[model samples]
Target chain A: MIETRGLTKTYRGGRPAVDGLDLAVPRGSVFGFLGPNGSGKTTTIRMLMGLIEPTAGTARVLGQPMPGAVRQVLPRVGALIEGPALYGFLSGRDNLRRFDAADPAADPRTRSERVGRALDRVGLAAAAGKKARAYSLGMKQRLGLAAALLQPRELLVLDEPTNGLDPQGMREIRALVRELAADGTTVFLSSHLLDEIEQVCTHAAVMARGRLVTQGPVAGLTAAVLGPGGHGRLAVTTPDPADAVRVLKEHGLTGLRADGDRVTGELPEAPPDGPAPPDPAELNAALVRAGVRVRAFGTQRPSLEDAFVRLTGEGFDVAG
Target chain B: MLRADLLRSEIATTFRRWRTLVLLAVLAGVPVLVGVAVRIQTGRHAGGGGGPAFLAGIAGNGLFLVFTALAVTLPVFLPMAVGVVAGDALAGEAHTGTLRYLLVAPAGRTRLLCAKLVTVVAFCLAGTLVVALSALATGALLFPLGKVTLLSGTSISFGEGLLRALAIAGVVALSLLGVAALGLFVSTLTDSGVAAMATTVGLVLTAQILDGIPQLQAIQPYLFPHYWLSFADLLRDPVYLDGILRNLGLQALYAAVFGSAAWARFTTRDITA
Candidate 1:
């Protein structure tokens, strides 16, 4: 489990890279840290890993306050931040050997065996003898993952693990993450890809401009965005668009945009002034009273993209 | 676990690098070149009046070539090689982005820095030993071996002279601890290995230059390399220890000051790379 209390990091004379934000990751969940680029996902991961001390606030990773208890805790956590940080001159096997030796608790006697097992786990056994500089980007990324798997870690923190990989490579990494989760390891995965996070994460948190916009289980996020008070858009597919628009306008629906036979507007049920606005049934009855032939009239189910857009007021860049 | 187990890995990785092998080869070549050059010159002029001050007495005893080779390479070659290795210790990792992995290994920055220091000192000792051994071999092959006359006009047995040569090599290596520590401290300040290496070597040259200037005599003793050649005192009868002791004490001072400085910087550093 990972817990953070107002964990913040501010560069000298610059804005906070990671603002005062709290994050909680339950054990054995594939926790997705979602954000757009420059949303401080990497900074938070780095602070949790104790690679950079928080400028303000604090964090506890796996039941221990980071940096202070790093030695006692880091061995149980595997991480690959940014990308594969490797020695270009050394062979992949030797690089793993060097990393394995870094853990004081590691058995030096079985170091080579552990290295071999890790390399095999990441499917880099065939390229283990090649210098890391000669490896393809995907190979290097796998090698980084291999270094993380050198021991039995209770948690795995991967920062954009599939950043430069081909589609196949990304799928492979995603599968590996799911496999690790199946083994009961807590995986705190940070990514800008909504679909990747949605596909792999059971629970998710969205960060925007160094702040936590929202956090919850994947289904809960959808429900939160779709509930009566949530920002749900209404779309009406009807042949009698003029009558439907007149009926919707009478109900005081604002920001109506229509093209051809389709009329779209925000759900207008929640009102400030008086009695609750008519329910879908009442609205349909009212439209029927107006002699409007209704084909389909319902609130649009919000996608993660829609919820993210509603939360951050900017569209998510799914292109990357 | 208290001791840095990473030292083994560091040594293995460092010595296996092509850069380290080239450094050792160049160091070993210095003695052979000095030995062969001295042999040819001394062969022609049996009663030579000129050459290096150390080679002046080599014809009387070939073992003196060890001392002569140490002197010839100590100024630039040996220290330059030490500078490259020491400077590359941390900066190279940062350049290649491996420092992040090492620190996150929870190796603890102080412990990792200590491991690097141990590796560099290990190299210094190995480098000094290689130069001494190569010069001794080359000298033994080129000249006659016999009882060696001391600088203080006292003669010692050949075995005792060889012992002295070993002692001298150790002293020379110890003298370089200051350079190694300084280079490591500089390494912590930068991420570029080449820049750190060039700066470390530049520091050595700067100190030597400062030591040589008459105007800078007031600050010469404060410089790390100022008392480097003081190992020559070990060849004197009565075993003069004043200059040798001063040189070691100075090296210890530099190592302590710069070693802790490097530790302080590296431990608190935000490893953004």
Candidate 2:
């Protein structure tokens, strides 16, 4: 478990990077930190990992006071912050061994075997022997993950773990994060990609301009209430576009757009408690009343991307 | 334990670098060149008539000169390299992003710094040993083995000269430790290896400059490079211990103070990488 109470961090000669934030990540859950660039995501993770001190407030990891109890807390936590740093001349195995020196009493053979398994887990067993400099960006990121997994820890903190990854690499990383969470390790990750977070994270927190807007399970976030039709993609096909607009406006549903024979618009994440839709059962009744014939009507569920954009006000592309 | 691991890791990494090999090869060959040059020069000077004692006397006087030159020059050239190698031990990793992995493991900052310091001191010792071994071989071949004359005009045996050379080498190694500590301290403040190396070298050169100024003579003993040649006093009749011991004490003081300061900085440092 990780908890921060009113935590704040202000960079010297600069504005507060993380401002008066309160956060709690339950154990054994994949918690995603969502924010755009310069949104204080990295700063929060750094403070949680004891890389930097908080300007005010207190943070605890696994029930220990941050940084002050770092020596004890760190052994139980594993993290990869910022970009991966590696020794170009040393192979992946050698890199692990160097840090493994923290526990010198461990059996070298067992350590090597654990390293091999981690390499396999990250799907880079074939490239483990090659110098890190020879590996691609994706391979290096996986190697960084492997290093984090060399020894088991209760909490794993990863910042933008999937950045710069291709489709296959992204999948592998997503799978690894899932597997880690499945093994009962608390995974706290930060990413701007809502799709990635939606795929793996069970809970989430959004940050905007250094202050946390809100946080909770991804499913529970109440999308802004939309009137009658709902706030999601609705496909309406009509022979007459002019008639559909008139009908929709009369029903009090605004923000409508038309392309060719179809008039389309979104509802809200949550349907407003106003009036019900003209009732698909009454589609014929409504069409006849408005002097138009409705060919078809279908509703598309709002994606996690739309939910994120609505919550954070940051325009995002679904395909990305 | 981290110190031992760091030492082993540093040894493996530093010894394998092309630069280190080139340095070792060059350093090892110095005595051989000196021997050949002495043999040729003295053979011509003697008109092929002098006995081995004359040659031995000539070599003894020249051997200290060789030792002195190696001591003074290697401290400047080689320890700066040691400083560069050791200074980057942590800062280099931080700059490149490897430090995050290490830190997340939550290894004690004290242990890691200790490890880096020991590795650098090892390099310093190895560098001085190279000079000692090279000079010993050159002294054996270029002149007679027995050394009966001292700089104070007294006399001792060839075995005594060899022993003194070894002692002198130890002193040189201790002096270099001080240089290594200075580098490591600077290492804690930076993330750029090039910047750390440049800063360490600049500091060393500055100390050397201060040591050389006549007006700074009173403060010279405090400078790291000042007593680098004090090992020569060991070759005197009574074996002058004043300057050599004082140099060792000062080096010890530097190593302790700088090493502790590095630990303090490292523990409080915010490792962004």
Candidate 3:
């Protein structure tokens, strides 16, 4: 678990990388951090990891103040920041062996085995013997992931883990994240890829220019902005548009638009007794009562991208 | 343990380069070359004659010039080598984006710096030994082994001469430590290896120039490179050990201060790379 109360970090002569912001990451859940480029996602992660002291306020990882308490929490945390930091001269096996020193309980053979398994998981098993300098960019990214996965710490913080990956690699990484979370590891990852987080994260936090826009369970997020009746994108093919319009008007809905065969309308604030917006049951019953044939009446949920745009505005990296 | 891993990784990475191999070869091979050159020069001076007179003549000249060259070169070149190696210890990691991985480990910044400093110190001592051994072999082959004369015009026994040579080597190592510490300090400020190397060499050249100018004598002692070769005084009959000790002590102080400064700066650095 991690928490920050009004944490702020300002670089000299530059905009504050992380502004006054509060954050909370619950234990045992995959918490995705979403933000745009230069949006202080990495800075907040760094502060949480205790790599840099906050310019103001306080942050705690696992109930310990950052940086000062880093040593205590480090044994229970694994992280991959920016890019993989490795000695290019050493082979991938050696690189793992080096970081394996952090885990004292694991012996050399056990460590190697763990490292080996991690490399295999990341699809870098074949390149384990090669010097890191010889690896390709995707290979380096995989190696970084392998290093992060070498041990199951209580918390895993990864920044942009899928930045340079191809579709296949991204799929592999997403599956790995799900697997880790399923095994009960709390993953706190920051990324600019909204779909990746939407596909895998159970919870997420949105940041903009170092400020936390909103954060909560993904389901909560969907309900809050996506609106009731499942963020209506209904593809209703009604036989009587005039009758449907009259019925919706009677319900106090407005902004109805018709294009060819489809009619779209924005639901007004839900009535006190109503079950959220665009209730499929209510609409179907109303149409049936009106003697109108309803071909399609499925609920429409906004894509995570649409939600992100709604939350952070256009031209921002909201997947962070 | 993480520190050891970092140190091992650093030593391994540094020694793997062709440049390191070439440097080691040069350290080993240069003495023999100097020995052959000394022998040929002695032969020319004697016009095909060889004896104690020729040997003593060559020995006297080689001890001063060749040994002096080694002393000056150790501080000048060896420290630069140490600079290149130590300077890259942290910055290169930052440059290649591997510093974050290292920092995120359980090891603290102090521990990381300790590992890097220990490795740099080892390299500095090893490099000094390389030069000393090379020069000693050359001195033995090109000239006779016997009592040696100091720059101050006093003579000392062969045993004493060898001891002095080792002492000088030790002093050379100590002197380079100062530069290495300074280099490491500079490394914390920048991520570019080339910039680090250039800055280190540039500082050394400036210090040497300051040391040479007569007007800067008052402030020269404060500069790290000023008394670099004062180890030569160890060979004096009366043995002016005071200056050598002072130089070594000054170098130690600089190492401590600069090294601590490097640690102070590094622990607080925002490693975005």
Candidate 4:
């Protein structure tokens, strides 16, 4: 678990990279940190990892103040920040061995075994002997992942684990994240890819301009955007647009718009504890009774992206 | 145990590199090349030709080659080599993006800096030994070994002479500790390994240059390399401790001053790379 109280960092002569923001990451949840480029996600992660000192405020990672307790806390927290920071001249196995040797608790006698196991887990066993500089981007990323998994960590904090990966590599990383979480390790990952987070995260937080826009369980976030009906849009295709609009208005729909052969109307807001929206069957029956030829009626439930856009405003880096 | 493991890793990663091997080989090769050149020259001319102080003394005792090699490499080659290794210790890792990973090892910045310093000092010892050993071997093949005469008109046994050579090599390595510490401090200031390396070597060159100018004599005593060659006094009969001690004290001062500076800079750094 990690918590922060107004954890802020301001570089010299510049704006704060991370403003006075509060954050809470509970244990055993695959928490997704969502944001755009330069949204201060990496800065916040660095502060928690004790890579950088916060200019103001403090962070408690694993229940201890950061940096002061980093030596004890970090070993139990596996992380792949930015990308795989691999030594180009060293073979993948050598890099892992070097990092493993740094951990005082790691048994040197079993270092080889641990290194090999880590490589195997990341699917880099075949290329384990090659110099890291010779590896492809995806291979290097996986090697970074392997370094993070040199031991069984209590938590995994991965920063954009699939930044430059192809579709297949992204899928592999996503699967690996799910597998780790399934094994009971809390995963706190920061990513610009909304779909990736939606696919794997149980809880998510959105950051914009160094502020937390919103954060909660994934289902709850999506449900928040579409009212209680859990659907974002409803559209009716009809030749008799006049009758369709009048009938839909009579049904107490608001924000109605009409075009040639089509009429769209916004349903009433369903309070969190309120009853569900009226069934489409009743709407169809009402339209039929009003002498309107309903060609088609379509409804779309809001996606994680749509909810995210509403939370962080437009132009979030959905693919980055 | 943690320190040893970290030290083992530092040494392993350092010595395994092709660049490090190349630097060592070049260091070890210098004595051989110098020995051969002196041998061919002496064979053609009847010991009338003069070279470096140790090369000139080789006709009397080949063991002086160790002294000569240490002396010859002290000014430029050795410090340049030490500068490269020390400068690259931290900055190279930063350049390659491995510094962050090393820190994530929770290798506390202080511990990591100390580990890097130990590795560089180890290189200084190893580099000096290679030159001394190669020179000793080449000198034995080229000249005779016997009771060595001291600089102050006294003689000592060959065994004592070997012991003195080892001591001299050690002193010579200690002479570069200042440079190593200084290089590490510069490394902490920059993420570019090349920039750090160039800056360190440039500082050494500038110090040596300043030490030469008569106008800079007032400041020369404070420079790290000012008394580098003072190890020559160890060959004196009474074992001139004044200059040697001063040289060592100056090195210690540089190490203490620059070592703390490096630690401060490194520990507070943001590690943006």
Candidate 5:
């Protein structure tokens, strides 16, 4: 539901914060925008939300040009940019009511009912009467989520939605996102947590240093990390690591390393001129034939974490 | 319909703050203090003509207390109160990060700005009424009520004097719109609410000081506070409209100029906060 073309924002006397970004978020997909801190994810989101105009380029949300069409488009889009910003003096319920009042399209007659539902959805209904200043960081984060869910939206753009939450709170937010997505609402979730993306996202985009490294379905990203053979490293635990290594090398497993009782090697790609790489079961039979006491044999599939690190050339906070 | 709701929300939020209440309390206190002080001074001396312009008349007619209180507070306390509210309107929202949510609510930038200005203007009226009403009540309790004397030395009924008092309170409130608009303009220039408030109040004080200087008389007519005290001319026999109209016109000019400036800056500027 969101698209950008050559979206670039260069602050005065500084490098472009978001340089030549072209993002396409589909209508019914949970799109994960993964990047490290200061990687322009928030900048891109801000531009998309029309909070800040792009120095050069254009952004469209729900098929209408941004900033220019903000009034027409934004009412249908819910956003929690950066974090939950609230009036500390106002109660959580009042905060929701105020934000609800801002939307011209929101029905005033049902505002209280909708605000209550949003608060309950975020598990903040009990604390709705309390001033927001007294809320914990996790509660504030949830209240921010509550504001975004105040109405049934066509698109929900959340930046770091799970930040400052306990493990339980994080799980709850993830579940909420899943529930929202299941209802056919497109969710644009941005985070540095690789695990969050892996757990919840259907489609994913990897960004590094203000540029898109790669993007596609989560399965495609993980599968693409492996070569054309779609094979990963072959790991074997044996009494005679030397014998197992010899057997694996004979089977054409490259980058063999033997340490203690374990021998790990890269399973080579299918050879065009020769033959296919031996399967893990075939390699195990070969190790057994070599008289190596095999304790364990498995192929380690690459994870999204490994894919993100490789794609971005930077480590991500893999912990949810 | 939505604009009305937004405006109601803005007005409710602005008046509900303890800071706003305290500012009103302080403004309301000024009239009581002045009325009590005048009562004491006249009681001790047994006559008038010792205090400020309107204070000396409070002993004969309690209604003069409203006039005295507005005169006393108009130059500083009233505008300072307006400055605080107006200056914090947008910047406070930005500092609290609520501005983004409000905007994203699709509260159109122009619509939100209009709501904020309306709320600030409401404060101007409310603040002035608080001082006037407080002074009227305190005046009734402290001094004798009788036929009212105009500044031109003509006698008018007490009801007419009361009507004139309400008119003066209104004029005093209108006198503050220039400062209100200026404060709102300053608010759009910063994210720090405190900084915006301080700058607005400082600008008002500086303009007052400049208006006071004889050397600056050439440009004094252009200053926002130049015609502030023209409300006193309302007490004249025919109720002089020259200075009152000029003050209102000057305030309208400032409101138009700075209000548009605020709109320009707010609509075009990036809301990073």
Candidate 6:
């Protein structure tokens, strides 16, 4: 639903904020734009929304060239850029009404009904009569979400949609996103929270320092970091730590370490210097044969956070 | 294509603000203050002269109060009120970050600009009518009402004088289009509403001061405020159209120039705020 070709934005006398980004957001997919702060996610989103023109490239939203086609394309796209910007003096309901009125395509006769429904969807219906200035940060975030949902959109571009929400609010927003995706709306979400992307996104693009590091399905990203068979490290909790370590080493597990009664080591898949990795069942049997009193045996799978950190060469705020 | 709903929304939002109400209240209060002051001065000294153009005639015919109040406020108070409203039109939205929402609502840039200009022009008419109505009511209460003597010394019926008064109010309102357009142009240049308002009002004051200088007479006629007081000629026997037409024409020139300038700057400029 959204595509960009060599999209770059360079401020005067400064490095490009968003550099040569070629992004594709498929229709009806929950695409997560994963990046750290100042990684050009918002800049790219702004360019896509046509709020700011890209200095040197082109962005097509909904298959129409942006800025030039803004009048034609924007009515079908809903956006919440940066945060919820509202008129503090106006009540939340009035705010929605005003925005609804701004859209020439919005049906005037059904405006009030739609605004009320949107407010209810964001859980702001009770507070609709109150001035937006009196709303809390989380409420404001929800109101911004309400604005994006005011009109049924073909594509929803949200920048940091869950930024100021509590844990419950965040969960609610995530659920709302899932629901919207289920209805076939293309969602382009950007955030620094790795957990959010992992929990909600079907596809994601990782960006670092204005450059795209990688992009694909979330499962594939984690699997890529895990290598073949998707195995990471094997941990064995046993009474005989030395015996367990000796057996694990004999089984060709690399980087064996023992602490107290636990032993852990890398379960390399198809190691260049060794035979293929043994099945976990056979490894458990080998430990049992060594007379190690095994309490628990498991292979740890790599997480999306680990994959993202490795791919971006930087740490992300893993929790929202 | 101007959307009626959007225009209604703009008008509603602009007028609903306490700031706008206060500006109108101040405008309404001006006529009362002038009426009461003239009533007191006429009672104290029997003859009123050397105050303002129409102040001396208020005691004889209450209708003159409308003319007097408009004359008193037109040069400063009226345009200043319009300056506040027009200058804040776009910049205020930018300051509050509502401009982005409005634009992305697909309120076409040109259409939104048109809506803002229409709202500001509406304010101009509303402000002028407020002063005129307040003066008329206060005039009726404080003094007698009857025939009005024109500036050419010909007496006209009270109804004709009232029609002339409405026309004069209209002329006064049209006289402000230049300031309204100039303020809108200034609004597009900044994201700070206060800065835009101050700059617009400051420009008006500077132009008025320049129009007053004898040394600047060569360019005085080109200033937007040069023909502002030409509405007084409506009181002439034949109702002189020369200065009134010139005033309207000059305002149209400023409106066209600044209106296009605003459109150019607003449509092309980035909306980062």
Best-to-worst ranking by DockQ = 5, 4, 6, 1, 2, 3
TM-score for each of the candidates: 0.89, 0.88, 0.88, 0.94, 0.97, 0.94
Task: Report how far residue B125 has shifted in candidate 2, in Å.
Answer: 1.0
**lDDT tens per residue, model 4, A107-183:** 89899999999999989999999998899999999999998998899889999999878999899889999999999
Docking class of 3: acceptable
List candidate 1 segments past 4 Å from native.
A222-301, A315-320, B1-4
Once model 2 is optimally superposed onto the true structure by TM-score, how far is the C-alpha of residue B65 displaced, in angstroms?
A: 7.9
Q: Against the true structure, whose TM-score is highest? A: 5
Residue-level lDDT tens digits of model 5 in A69-184: 99989888888999999888899999999999889889999999999999999999899999999999899999999999988988999999999999999999999999999999
Ten residues in a row with the worst lDDT in model 5 chain A? A311-320
DockQ of each: 0.62, 0.51, 0.45, 0.73, 0.83, 0.71
Candidate 2 structure quality by residue, lDDT tens digits, B1-273: 343654465567767667666776766676566567667877677544343222334444545534643654455666776777767777787888766666666656776677677778777788778876776667656565565467688877767766777777777788787878888888889888778888888888898888788998898878887777777787788889988888888889999988888888988888776
lDDT winner, 2 or 3 = 3
In the range A198-305, model 6's lDDT, one tens digit per residue, is 999999998888878788788887787655645577989988998888888888888889998888898867869877668989999988887888999998877788
Which residue pairs come into collision in candidate 1?
Answer: none
lDDT of 6 at A113: 93
Clashes in model 5: which pairs? none
The CA lDDT of each predicted structure is: 0.88, 0.75, 0.76, 0.88, 0.91, 0.91
Candidate order (TM-score): 5, 6, 4, 1, 2, 3
Chain A only TM-scores, each candidate in turn: 0.81, 0.85, 0.86, 0.90, 0.93, 0.92
TM-score of 6: 0.94
Note each model's CA RMSD in angstroms.
Answer: 3.9, 4.2, 4.1, 2.6, 2.2, 2.7
- For residue A88, give model 2's deviation from the true position in Å: 0.4
lDDT (10s digit) by residue, model 2, range A120-160: 88888988889888988888888887877877878888888
